[model samples]
Target: MSRPHILAVAKLVPLLLDQLHTAYVVHDRVHEASPEEFAKVASNIRAIVGGGESKVTRALMNQLLALELISIMGVGYAGVDVAAAVERDVPVTHTPGVLNDEVADLAIGLMLSIARRIPQADQYVRAGRWGKEGAMPLTRKVSGARLGIVGLGRIGQAIAKRAEAFGMSIAYTARSAKPDLTHTYYPTATALAEQVDFLIVITPGGAETRHLINAEVLAALGSKGYLINVARGSVVDEAALVEALKDGVIAGAALDVFEKEPHPSEALWTMDNVVLTPHIASATWQTRQAMADLAAGNLHAHFAGEKLLSPVPECN
Candidate 1:
């Protein structure tokens, strides 16, 4: 029997790519194929695979007459048109939980990096300004500070756990209160920002959450506070953040994700009060391998007539 045809819409890691090739006849990036070429194979494709940032639109799904599953190699599936997939009776699975620790670790890391000016200090020493200009200015302390998390999901909970170790007071804002947790809950992001010294965003992205953290929230954070974003960039208004940073509406910011990824606003490039990372919250080798394995496992399970390992909440 011929192997099932798999369409890769995004740039997948080599490990996952190799595994897919071994089990199926993989068409790497069929979205990039010529119109005629894509038409020839579209109906035969049985599955779709992509990374976190991949775009799987309704049009693409409409072309796949036999698409049974979509396996995403990352936790965030904001780019996938999940409603369209569900309407088509296709289930979407993503690798979650596996990378919770990694993302949480990066959140804490970014908080420290920004609050203490670690990156700036390193630059100062590298430029020999530290020796020439005398002692560097004192930075904020993380321990015993108030922390407000924008989301209280698994990753957010992990971050809160770490903050507790630093003796930080933790609070959060979610769609609604989580009754089991003892931490303080706020009804809105602005309210949470006003009460915390460091505000970390770890919420999901989409129209409902787009620009959830806006000028009001940043202003509430105040000039003495800081912003740390380890969530989707759309969750925060990038333009507002830029303006706030420029006006010192907030003390500083550390961001891993941006509205325009791999190409954040040029203005952010020169800001000394900001620390930026290339959306690598789950980029570690071990975590990536685990993600790849889970993604491939979902595909394998679907093809084998078994239950999926981690279907997205929407699909469930």
Candidate 2:
């Protein structure tokens, strides 16, 4: 029996590559395949494996006449064309729940890193300026501070749980109030920002959430407040965030994800007040391995004619 052909839209970890090789003929970088070579094998390709950053467009899917499943290695599937997949009755699966803790942990870490100026303080010590500059300027505290969370879903609740251990008070804003919860709910992001010392965004990225935290919300947060985003970068207005930082509309920001990604605005790089990460919120070895396993499992399930392990909400 011939192995099923799989198109790899994004690079996979070595372990997953080994696992996939055993049962499938993996085509690495189908996007860059030679036209003749791609044409020869395109119709035989039955599955596509990609990450959150990979583009799974309708046009691309249209090329793979035999495509049955699109599997994503991460929680966010904003880049995948789910509607297009649904139109063809092709299911899209992603690894969720597995990375919730890692993301929540990073959100809290970013809050403390920005609030206490941990990165700056480390730089101060490394430059031997601690003695010369004297005690690295007093920074704010985190314990017992008010924390307002935007999008109080699983990860948001995880963050709130972690923040509670630090004695931080919690309030949140979502599309609607979640029943059975005790935290205060604000209908608007601006209203929530106005009341908290730290405003953390963990909302999904899409049309409805794009720029949910706009200039008005930043202004409401005020200069004493800090912003930490572990969610989609589009959730916050990047240009407005830059302006707010320049004008001291908000004290500072620590971001794990950015609007442009790998190349966030050059303006943010020069600002010592901001802490930026290269979208590694769920990049831990264990978490990444688990996500890879789940993604691979979805592909295996699809080929085995069994139920998918983690189908996206669109398919479910």
Candidate 3:
């Protein structure tokens, strides 16, 4: 059998190199790359192993016409250009279902962190700022609070189940309503925002959901409510969110993902109410290894003349 050519854009920190070695996976385990190094791949490489949120731009797709396939290593495919891929007959695959628990866990944690001011309080302790001068504002409870989820996909369901354990009632708005959930289903994001004490965004990030949680929805969540976004930052408007947070339009926010990764706005930095972390919703050692293995499995399938396990839908 001819050896397959696979190019991975990012590194896999948690996955076992030995296991992947035996399976004939050629990967770049070191994620940090200089721009010049990436440019080489941008110019030469054919196939790509990228995050589900990483796009195969028009230029890259042109390059891949001569390559094998692009295997996305995560569940989110907002970065992948499905339209262009189809135009070129290039198959795209995503890591779905497996990362649900990890991402949902992050969502739930962010909800708790913002509501309880966990990150702020931790910083206070670490920086010798706790009880430095005055008493801090009392934190809120995640348990017994109402949670509204924007999208109820696999991760949303997983979050709902986790929230239930914390005594949270789950209400959500989806493309089509889910009638089975005991928790109420709202028809719109606006309605969901108005009802819940905490709003957790588990929706996909794309043109459809871009800025879905805008100033109006922020207003609907009310001054006492908190927002937790473990999804994409594009789903929330940064300027409006900073304004709302500054004025306490909503109580606080906790975010793991951002509209512009590696650099979030300077506005959010001054706000004591917001908790920000680099996008690490799927950063758990075990979970990430699973994702890589699954992505690698998808690539193996395509190269072996078999069907891809998790190909992104042609419609999406």
Q: Largest lDDT belongs to which candidate?
A: 1
lDDT per residue, candidate 1, 13-59, as tens digits? 89799899898999888569677888889999999999988899999
Task: Give Cα-based local distance difference scores for all models.
Answer: 0.95, 0.92, 0.79
lDDT per residue (tens digit) for residues 1-316 in model 3 = 5444455665544363344455543536222355455444444444667775665677656654455577788777877778887777778888888889989988888888888888788777888766575656788977888999999988999999999898887899988887677768888899999999999998998999999999999999999999989878899998899899988899998888888878999888878888888998988888888887888788778767897888887734
Query: lDDT of model 2 at residue 80?
Result: 90
User: TM-score: which candidate is best?
Assistant: 1
Candidate 2, 261: how far from true, in Å? 1.6
The runs of at least 3 residues in candidate 2 whose Cα sits more than 4 Å from the true structure, single-residue gaps closed, are none
Q: Which ten residues in a row have the lowest lDDT in candidate 2?
A: 30-39
Residue pairs with colliding backbones in model 2 are none
Supply the TM-score for candidate 1.
0.98
What total of clashing residue pairs does each candidate reach?
0, 0, 1
For every model shown, what is its TM-score relative to the native structure? 0.98, 0.97, 0.87
Q: Which 10-residue window of candidate 3 scores lowest in summed lDDT?
A: 24-33
